[model samples]
Target: MAAATHAAAGRVSGASTSELGAAPRPAPPAIQRVRRRRRPSGEAPPLPRHLATSGKLWLALSGVVLAVWAVVFVTDSIAYVDVADTRILQAVAEVRSDPLTQVAEVAGGLATSGAIHVIWLVNLVVLVLVRRWRHLFVWLVTGLVVVNLTAVAAAMLQRPRPFEVEIIGRWSGFSMPSLPVTVLATFLVSTLYALVPAGRPREIGKWVVCALLAATAASRLYLAQDHPTDVVTSVVLGVAVPLAAFRLLTPNEVYPVRYRRGRPAHLDVTGARGAAIVRALQDQLGVVATKVAPFALSGSGGSTPLRITVRAHPSAAAEESCVFGKLYAATHVHSDRWYKLGRTLLYGRLEDEKPYHSVRRLVQYEDYVLRVLWDAGLPVPHPMGIVEITPEREYLLVAEFVQDAVEIGDAEIDDAIIDQGLSVVRRLWEIGMAHRDIKPANLLVRDGTLFLIDPAFAEVRPSPWRQAVDLANMMLVLALRTDAARVYARARKQFSDEEIAEAFAATRGLTMPSQLRRMIRAQGRDLHGEFLALLPYQLPPVPIQRWTLRRVGLSLITVAGLALAVAVGVDLVGSPL
Candidate 1:
């Protein structure tokens, strides 16, 4: 984490301001803070960044790689650098022997073009099959950049391989940055990050790869095929560049590279992300959160759900309070866009499901809506302002976590509960807005009061048909806990026969939230059918499959894209370097 943290307000070197020449007139607030805590000692990450410690370390490594490369590149022009490189090569040549030559031959053969190509194809094809677009993109991009940079650097430097030395190992091309070694390193990184799981597996993978790389570099040096500088720079650029790129682009915390498929990309709520969340709430929202853990993840899809326990807000308060937080990252933003795209294809011009541009925009809209609802005195949770975790990449949406409440589906419903649930939609109708998603999971029951949560799908001034779907979904959820006839009888108190009929008419399969639909399937209940029977007269079910030119175009584009991605995965093979 690269955030500024104020230390305990103690003078350094046991000196007071009076003793240290008036403390140099107190540095400007920002500068003073920076001076007090120059190191990223206790700060949480992604803070006005430098992001995570790993990110900073990688950046520093890349800088060192470039600096060393500069020195090696100038070895031919500079006296001392040339002397050092020549001496090292001479010393390596002194140890040449038949046994070592054979060993070099074997080590050189280990990282072959065929092996690189095979590993490359395997990662590409597997990532495609598992729909790991984020990993695949980073893998491909990192490979392309490293390989191209290797070629460019070699050509520009044009340093012939270890001048005036006998070459015992097979080699080609100018060898300032060792093209074979570069490609080997690139593929090793790609394999480890894309195929291996994170944590201990990857940590162990690093040491294993280090041994392999060291052996390969040693073989090249022993064979006198590359300058020591050549192999050194190669390993640095090859390993460090891609390592940094993968860490920054596809952080394991957000996008872990695993074999299991179809699980939602929920961020792990421990380690750096957890500590960052605690600090973010304190720095941004001024709440001292003691613990933050994932809460009811199975019910959430758009963002990682969290239950935050905070300390007292006022001195009078003794017990801690738990607030709910939705941690939205780039993954959730992609999910939102895909969800909206599917909605657009299924129902054209629904006038509600529009894709946001970035994670910030997504969190901003939710926070804004939450604030609006709370201001309007709706039953939704009161939102604490968004806490930025990684600039625009991640954010936390804090709000009231209803204590001792169960999903309306699990709760025992009463007449008042049903009426309150129904009236929530009615109130939205009166306010010219729509809850959009009226599933049981989104509705909660505490005592007799019904609370609405997860308005990520809610819309302002939605179409009457969309609002009708909301009402129908709500009524179905209510009927799931009680009888449909009773729910209908109570619904008539607020909704007229024609309006209720319109809502049921607009409602059908796929119109209801998937959670509600799945619940219905699990319960083996025909709640929708029962409600339709109780209506005054059956209206023809509104057509849900809206076939428009936009839908047709998007469908064609999507199919074409999928086919293209798979085709590329299958056939996008090339020489290792």
Candidate 2:
């Protein structure tokens, strides 16, 4: 009936009867789709508050107690005298015949010198297997220090071991903190760490270790080999020293637990490898660097590679000093291979990109290229020498730092600056080379001369298209920073109207350097409109075939890599034989 009435009304209103007669369609069902959370790259979970502060408090408290104990031991103060040793020894002597005492004696005997040595060997093997270098270092150093400090403390106090019961085998040293108790506690802590990774397993392992530690400390007191106070102090030192050392040495970002150690080091300027490079530079370059410091930026403003500045004293007789160094490392270099491969799969080809082959080789190649440019009298940083930290893992390039130079992007760009930048492009092209990464950051102005900084992207006998990219990139950088009219005007002086058009045309399907692309995207304002407006001719956008032969080849390579990875995994896991 409603349909009939609706049809009559539609006829009256000159609407189609078919629409009115049609059955009303049911509403689409709502979907309860699940969405996974996405965190920004390199983001880490926030450290818990207790983990951030607890270690320090524990360290301070233990340190204060130890200090008070040391003062009493040293000054022979009447307060808190050696009565603890007598009382504890008397208590333990009464329990000498108990079954628990016999059990503790057996356990203590098992935790002897031989057993402790075996435990250390086992811990070492586990740490090596897991590649826990940082943990291994902290474990070894803390153990050695604790042992020595305990010995020193016992000797200084000249405390005597308890004689209330049958003495443990070969006991001669004075007992301030029980050596066996200290060794057991520290060994348990370090051993559990090396054996288990963080998770439920580790949490359970930690509790087990804590129980073992308490038992071992109690055993020392039960056997009356040391006073109750001695065992208590030994346990405190064993735990506290490593905790303090961890807090001091390890970064909180790497580990959630404040005093947790054994994280890979973030190789920064202050690391062992970095210091070695600096020393190598001094020897090879024959210039003693009075001081080496990290420059706040050394890049184009975006997160490019990091460079270090060194203040070198050329001669002992001279007071004259100079700043000279190189842009050596970037955070990307650490994971460059995987990053480059992922990018290749997404984007067609990264031809101008650094060799995804290996970081050391890439760095070495850059050093070599910089030397070549310097030898050719091209305006670049004067090459000092290459510091090989690791043969195939790490490297450092030493070069003359342009002391009073300013980035082209930061500088007051004018017609003169634009002209000079263009001239750099032209000169490179004339010499059968291309500064493939012709970006504003790479171009620096010092004393009215434009000097190129990172020539890592330079290529010899490059294709005509590669040379054209250099031209377009130089123009693009200038146009983005300043007005296009000024750039176009300056460009016209060196390049013809048609030649300028050709340069812009060549950028159609060109693979831009990552740094240049990043800088352009990060710009607050777009320059493409201004660029088009200032163009002498409208060139058609070059059509890029998404699924070309190159892409197909890359796809096959990716498949092979995945297959090989699977095969290696199968081999590692083994068949269910």
Candidate 3:
């Protein structure tokens, strides 16, 4: 009845019946976007509130504590420090029984230089087993700084151990903040951060370590090994300095102490963040995500690939609970910049080698391309917009998951699939866009249709060379599935012999993505050479090494920056403090 009424109205109004019968589109749901500063290339994301404030607090506390110790004792500006030291020392000396001293002596042995050697040996083994070079370096550097600073300060003050007190326990170079206890405290803090994962385990470890350190301090004081002032000062430096260093450099969120089997680039999708992802999808995107897990992580290095299961949504495509998402964080942004910068230095601005300034921008590119490609009648997942996870710090780019589809490499690639694959590149050319990263992993087959994913590297109106390389990569991927002859035969249908020849000419070393390059090398396949043989006549190979002023400038800056980092590292290692 409504269709009949619409037709009558269309005739009366002189409008097309189809147009009058068409359903009105639903309004898009509102979404909130975090507009924090787009972190510049090579810049780390801003630290979490607790991490930043904690580091500053420790630094300030240590400085103030050191300053007070210096004035009270080092300069003898105040008389209370000595009197307190003497009374504490004399009282400790009163419990000088042989058995008690022996016990005290055994406890104090933990602070000896020998104990440091043992701790380092164990820590080195653990760090190496886990391949935590960053943590190991920070741990060693913090120890060096603490140890050397102690020596320099003690020497400058020349403060004696105690005022006429009989020394029962083993003694060290200086009295101020017994060196053994200080070393022990610093090592404990380093162990907690570098080895233990955060949560209840780390929180409990903190208490255990604190108790141990307190025991050590009491044992030293009981043994009459040093003045009370020295012990107090040592505790402040040992705990504060390393805590600040680790928190600032190796943030738990960025470089977590995970004992997992995957690369650190993959963020943990479990726990609070996982639950939050579920909740965010339900509230913001109207996606009732029942399950969210890391998906096909081997191919994805820049962002964490997530397979989000949708319980319900307005879109029928999402009814099967097949939603794909990529979690982008600060680390991915920095990685994209470095990858592009390296390409720039090596190849001199090969079409669209510019890095994104922020993770949001990096992800928005993929979201934008998905929309553009889908609208252009290309085979790509429907883009479900970006879901803000940690405001600007993290976001998830959600889209259709292409459920039950397998990689073209793993799937049976028949002539239909091969034709669809070549047609994709042809469509790309017609539209003047390029999927700069066309490889096997990015190519998926679902019911004989070829789909492209990971549009983070896609560019519109790319150079002819860039477009040509896209053709070459697609052919290589298709050819790998079947023989070169079949793939090339189908490719010629959409592209000319000259265009096919040009594709091979532009394709060579460094033209392909890292994963594709590795797979080709590992399989001992010369798909490149095979594809070229199929070309009618090979043109001269495209020259990729185009050196420009910008390339030269970036190359020089990279070299200079590396040299400066090396120099600073050497100075830090060689310095006494």
Candidate 4:
């Protein structure tokens, strides 16, 4: 597990006196009393071991390759003065009239000024439009440096073209490192660097790009346009330039995650920005002259909410004052635009996708629901307040921290704990609400008490089917975490057989959260099989429903968006470059 951290007061160290202005107002007694004297250390947890190892290895390998290439290029340049390099060029010149010359000429065409410039221009435009500033910088700088280096090396070496030996292709300029090969190779490799996802895609892309580069280099050499050494130099430049640039410009993470219009791109909730968020909370609380300390916890990786623990200045009463805050920001996901569009077209009439809903609405809804649950005497995290970090970009919801709590997956669950967990669901049902997301992570156990947290997906007065889903998910999650027979036997204490039947029935269309899916997969537990083994009833397979207006509309919209994406892709492909 990789962890990055920021201390509340660390950023103030080098600030001017004016910048270290007065802190926010003191919080209320209830809020202030929970402040803790001890703070989490500022040290960041080492990045995931694999990521750190791979990054160091990648940089080391790139440096070695670049050095070797540089040595080879310099050696070849010096050797050319004695026609030692020309001997190799002269041998390649003998094959100029072969049919392979045409193939080589066509391969060389991919590196023409028009093709190179067009591809570069289109890629640049896409980068700018998508606001990929770091990638944009890297792409632009790598291209400029590679091109200028190629030109300078060519001019300095003044390696003559192979025309002296009856080279077949029409070509000009001195070529020690073939300019066309250099340009095309860099362009292809750089594009792959920018777009390829990690894991298998990256591995496959690397091989494919290498093959293309090898073919291009071989063709340029066989066609007698550039010397064999020139092509080799180009291949080396192609690999080294982009690798070096990305190392310098990109984040240290093996796979850096990007989000849009959220907390500042560089600021995680645990850093100086977190301190600012505390100030914002103070403003909301109308408290003046209070210090806030925030400790960020590891969030669900990628686009989920940001979670942090904040402690305000202690009050005279000295109550343990720690508040848990969850933040929602517009994350930049590759599928977000299409997902949003599809959501709009399909379920525009029915807005149930709370996770992907607007930040303001999501925060407000969760905060309200938490308050409702807390006020109703349910075992839930107490709602503190809500803060708007940015109008639509980011928002935070503060709640009472469940002291000494651990996720159920980390807890020693027994029959009593299972019953306590069921009580929470029963209480929610009694209060006419349903917590749509009930899983191990959401259930906290402390001192034999169970508390439910993060009811952002809960619904007031939900349909019977929705309530059944809540029960089913809760029971399924509980069963997976603890003993299935024990959970089933315990569940019978509070829930009727009919209700259990309804719970299983409602699971037919239940869309399991990603976290639960991962847990199920990791544990190698078959949920449906377990359910049947426990109950041993034939669950009638529900008929697949026909497309409703929402489904149809969303389908059409998705198809249209994909079509538009394809058309844009075609235009990009077909456009002159």
Query: By descending lDDT, how would the candidates be arranged?
Result: 3, 1, 4, 2
lDDT of each: 0.75, 0.60, 0.76, 0.61
1-577, model 3: which lDDT tens digit per residue?
A: 6576445434433432222221111222223222223335664322222456656777788899877866676566646677788898888788778888778777776677666667766886899898786797788789877877777788877777776787766665767656676778888899999999998999999998888788778788887777887788888889898898888677777668989688767998887678878767765666667789999999888889999766544444444355789998876776678778987887788767777787778778889988888777677877888877765567889987776779888899887777777767767776789999898889887766677789878999989999999988988888776888888887655666777888889989788988888878887889898888777578999898888999999999999987875665454334331
Best by TM-score: 1
Q: List the residue pairs that clash in candidate 2.
A: 135-262
Candidate 2 structure quality by residue, lDDT tens digits, 358-399: 556667777778877666556777766665444444455666
Candidate 3 Cα outliers beyond 4 Å, as residue runs: 1-49, 52-77, 97-160, 167-184, 199-208, 215-219, 222-225, 313-320, 337-351, 518-524, 545-577
- Candidate 1, residues 1-577: lDDT per residue as tens digits? 1121112112121232222222011111110011111225565444333435764775687688788668755675444555677788788888888897898878876466776787787887788788887888888878777777788888887777666567777778887778888878877877788778998998999898888898888888888878887777777777777777777777777787766534555778888789888877876666778889988877877788998887754442455777889999888888678878978876774665568889998888888887776666567876767888877788989887887889988999988788777767776776678887888889888877788889887788788898889889989998887899998987766666767888889988778788998999999988888888887677787876677788889989989988875655444355334
Order by TM-score, highest first:
1, 3, 4, 2
In model 4, the runs with Cα more than 4 Å from the true position are 1-30, 33-267, 270-272, 286-321, 332-351, 354-357, 508-510, 536-546
Cα displacement (Å) at residue 268, model 4: 2.6
**Candidate 2 vs. true structure, TM-score:** 0.51
lDDT comparing candidate 3 with the true structure: 0.76
| Deviation of model 1 at 496, angstroms | 2.5
Top model number, lDDT:
3
Model 4 weakest lDDT span, ten residues long? 1-10
- Model 2, position 361, has a per-residue lDDT of 62
Q: How many backbone clashes does candidate 4 have?
A: 11
Candidate 2 residue 46 Cα shift, in angstroms, is 36
